[model samples]
Target: MLENSNNTVLSEVDTFTNHYPRSSIKRITRYTTLEELHSLANKPLLSIGWLIICQDTAIKNSYLKFLEGLDQSNLVLFRITSEQKCSELLSALKADKVQYRIINNYKLKEEKVIDYVCKNLSITKVDAKYLCTRSGYYLPEVVKNVQTLKVLPKITKPIIRKYTEDRRSIAVYDLVNYLIGIGGKTTYEDCMQLVYEYRYGFEHLLKTTLAQITVYIKIYNLILDGELTLANCKIKKKDLQDKEISNLHDFRLYKIVESFDKISYDYLILLQLKLQQISPKFYSGVFDFVALLKINAKPGVEARVSTKINTKISSKVKEDLKTSEKRLDEFNRKRYTMTTDDCQKAFEYLKEQRDK
Candidate 1:
């Protein structure tokens, strides 16, 4: 099938026909009306079926309206992102009503990029390394950079470095650790450097941060409830399996539990709040995400965490804390029956006890 790069229809079809006169191909785009789609789908096929490329600028629920009752079995729209295959789309495809199967994005490995560069450009491993570094190991970026230097009489690491802008990337885990105050003392500038070094979209980083925070919060709650005791740095295997915390490695969990007291609970709560606020503004183009992190990580925030605790606790509040912990544990065990709002309320109840 001919790849749909642009909107020019007649010329591309002509070129395809000239190459393979026996085969027939038709292109359907996002702009194609429902009526037009039906007309095209119903047309007499010289071949088995038509391969249509639907390129929608803004994917929405309304697009599904175009295919509700269509009976085009041979039409296939395969090159789509995972996000586009919503629940509604899945249901249609599952019932065999929809003919197309949307596919997830495929990422290229570093080895593939290195092999391509070495074979096509006749460059050494050293030169290929420079290209990979400069392009941040992104397939499209690397291809674009190499194409610019392919016409040159000779290619070298220095020449590639000089010609292409440096977008060398950092490890995602390293940056996440720095942002969450795991290993080292980090400044706002340090966090920003890591953020800028990431080549993928900010959405991936945001999702990763949310997931990591969830893990930390679960561990924190376990410590508060005396389930994972900090004094002994040990937990029962059955407890881990029950709470779904078994995915964490043994040594890593031990380190986190040991250092849990060192990391301020207040700061983590502040960071989680800031992350939730900025999530809606992620695509607004107005908010600075790094600035939110900077504000949350301001000096003296961690100082709010006190090592000293009140020895005397009222019986009522103590009972309430136990009740909240029980509810949270239950929610963790049977999450399908409990919403995130329920978990938040339990946390707030625990917070009130801590304050008392």
Candidate 2:
């Protein structure tokens, strides 16, 4: 009787399992849409889905109109504006269903907008990715923003290593000088390659080395800071002349001195040659210390050295040392035998002359 009852229970279980809905067991493919966005606003404590609309004026107007046509009881359109009047206008038009915000101009400047979105919105990465993919105008910037947000700091170490392993620091500095010499224009890929080639060819420096990576990071940071700019290859190549080319050496020396203070002049010169050996593109320019000095002259001797070393002035600071032997030529031609008093008087005269 126990076995019969067990069999009965098993049959009932099987019958129930057979009747279970197959559709319910199937995977549901969910997608985001305007309807789902509306439903998100209906909860007692609603969390709004922030849509960053970066479209042309006409498209923006059309979107505003579409939102106005909807049952916007739960939806609030947030319009970001630059002009104070535009914000007021937008607020007046969609008084009940929309909100207006004025974002600081600086906040929209390169990569800052991403920080803004991450800070202001309560959203998932998937949702952020989706919004970035759908937006037309600021899409790339937004994607970059999200990437910057999600990227782990430790991951940057590998890139730094690759930079150093490639001897890219030398290449990057060379490229910067080349760009400056050629009037600050070049294709992005060409500039990227200028550094990348160094990394690929040099095996002594590994991408894993901290020292090597640090150099690359320093070079890139200079570029980002507008201390260096990249230009198109065709333009730079066309602008290249013997005179402009010769100045490249002096410019490089100046940059090194600027970056690393009072480095042995011999070491600085040797590094220039080593860089040239590693990359022939470096040899295209000449070094003009005198010209550099004229361009970067300061008010006094101490100030001059201070400014040159500190400010990265591309010139020689020790011109007096260079021309020290010629100092006697500045004296008057007549020689007179003199006592200590005469010598003191002459010294005072000479001091005044030198000051002039």
Candidate 3:
């Protein structure tokens, strides 16, 4: 019964999140269930909201199977995109008392969205129309393209075509792992090829790569200190929200933790150090940082194979980690104690590390 069309589900979700600016809104896909909703309902003090966006047929089927269990008493608000499913739930077969909101009436038209972009960016109706058409009139896609366009000096039809061209087949996750030398080596050409293939801005890729590095560093430290073991490495949903852990699936989290068995800690730290060095320079020029990564960010196979010679390299990495820790600590300390120019430099360094 799950219906699909040119739904404005994403824009509605964006509006919901914007409405509850201070609420700890949890966004997920098929992970949501009646039990999970009840668990959240029990914690009213958290002031949490739930936004579940599912396009998968399997997930929709799974949801339909449990629709009878849902009642009006449930506190969660479902902004489902499917009109048929909503109608079915409201029918006599399910719960007629079930409350819901249909967003189809509020959906933005192509002309309206294009005009918004045109007025906001001070661009002509032609360029804005092109962007909206290329972006499929999706609000988030249009916003992302607008941000990318803002970085450039001038907008051109060719540039819009380049940025809006979608290559859904490319696995950017594998490219990211390769960039950090997880499964294989990476090159500047490979990096730029990914840009062209995926059509994701370099800033987006850089932030994604940095996020993976941060997660690996956190998980690696826990493993090294004997605080976490693969046998008992289960992470709860609440812990993810509490500790601000990346909202990754359990399978992906497990795979990331398991990767440490083959990848060396030293290699991860080396890649992290290189990212830290270029991060500050990113504000000056993104190409400059990319060039730096090309020159110094390549982790060699020798380091990758260190897991085989752990006894020897483990000690060296531990010693080097101590020194690296001191350097990082000093770098952080200087942010508060440093002069104006130094503070601005530190600000840019931290800004590059953040995913905005």
Candidate 4:
């Protein structure tokens, strides 16, 4: 009960509070689509707590769209993720005259990764520490691989061990596989999907890995044919800037040329050098990237291209990728009725070649 201005005591239900109490009627949740966001905006908020916004841009945009659609008198409560994101959210909220709180972005440190796995994954501290310690400083990949590991039991998977052994190699392999899977023609979103879903066995995850393997195959073939030589193909540029190259809308080519950032084919060159140190036959040449790791390869490209394979091997990889996706879809429909035969055939081939 609350006292009115006239000094009369009355229950909240006796007034407009009956429609919306002094509390949030809707619980806290993540809004997946624009529809859900609008549904909440239509409701009245009795408290300063309702929506929870995370790091995903797609979902965050929807939340901002919802808030902007409301009037200034409307009450909007939301928490935006901090740490290298939420600029769009902030701008949208500002436009709508909304207010929000900025909390830590939940960044992963070296120890934090280990702790999360140990606590949430039901694994021993020793195992979790071992996993994080080996994956090095690539925190995002470490988190994803750890989450993938958490999905299964504590036993080590080959892919998980490979990820721990070298995240850069796994990243390059996935990047190359992703590029090849699209037949050297795709958008940035597709590239992100391959990198983000590399661990969870996205049906087409290994297509570019195989394509990368095949690119090496083509390089080796060229070397044997005397058509290309690493000595002649070596790129010579002083202080190449990767940040500038990242804007180059060609996923197929720039993924190899852009060396200014963490995710680039320049890392693949480094990986190739490391592989050659272990075994000469791994690449048999001083460079990978089709022995064409130069940025000035005639500025070659056309945007939003189709699946055009430079090699005959891509068709086979594409077929295998489709089959792997089918298996994943089947598993989704019936979790117990899944088999590793198609998956093993697609991935194990790359794994065997990756190690050898």
Best by TM-score: 1
Lowest lDDT 10-residue stretch of candidate 1: 2-11
Please say which candidate is ahead in TM-score: 1 or 3: 1
Which scores higher on lDDT, 2 or 3? 3
Note the clash tally of each candidate: 0, 15, 0, 4
Q: What is the lDDT of residue 266 in candidate 1?
A: 44
Residue ranges of candidate 4 with Cα displaced over 4 Å: 1-85, 95-97, 104-107, 121-126, 133-288, 293-356
- Which portions of model 2 show Cα errors greater than 4 Å? 1-54, 60-66, 74-161, 164-297, 300-356
* lDDT (tens digit, per residue) of candidate 2 on 1-356: 00111122122223323433432121111233445434433333322222222211223443445445544333232322223234334555666555544333312332333344445345444443334332321534444433553543332323322322221122343343332222134433333343334434333222212232233334333433445433322223223353322223333423432443322232223223333333223222111211121122212222212222334323432542343333222111111122345334534654453233
The digit string of per-residue lDDT tens for model 3 on 139-173 reads: 77777778778766667677776666432222456
Tens-digit lDDT track of model 1 for 263-311: 5454555556656656533334113355444433556434333343434
Candidate 1 deviation (Cα RMSD)? 15.8
**Span of 10 residues, lowest total lDDT, candidate 3:** 1-10
TM per candidate comes to 0.46, 0.20, 0.41, 0.32
lDDT of 4 by residue, 175-198 (tens): 554332222443333343333335
**TM-score, predicted candidate 2 vs. hidden true structure:** 0.20
Tell me the whole-model lDDT of each prediction, alpha carbons only: 0.53, 0.32, 0.53, 0.41
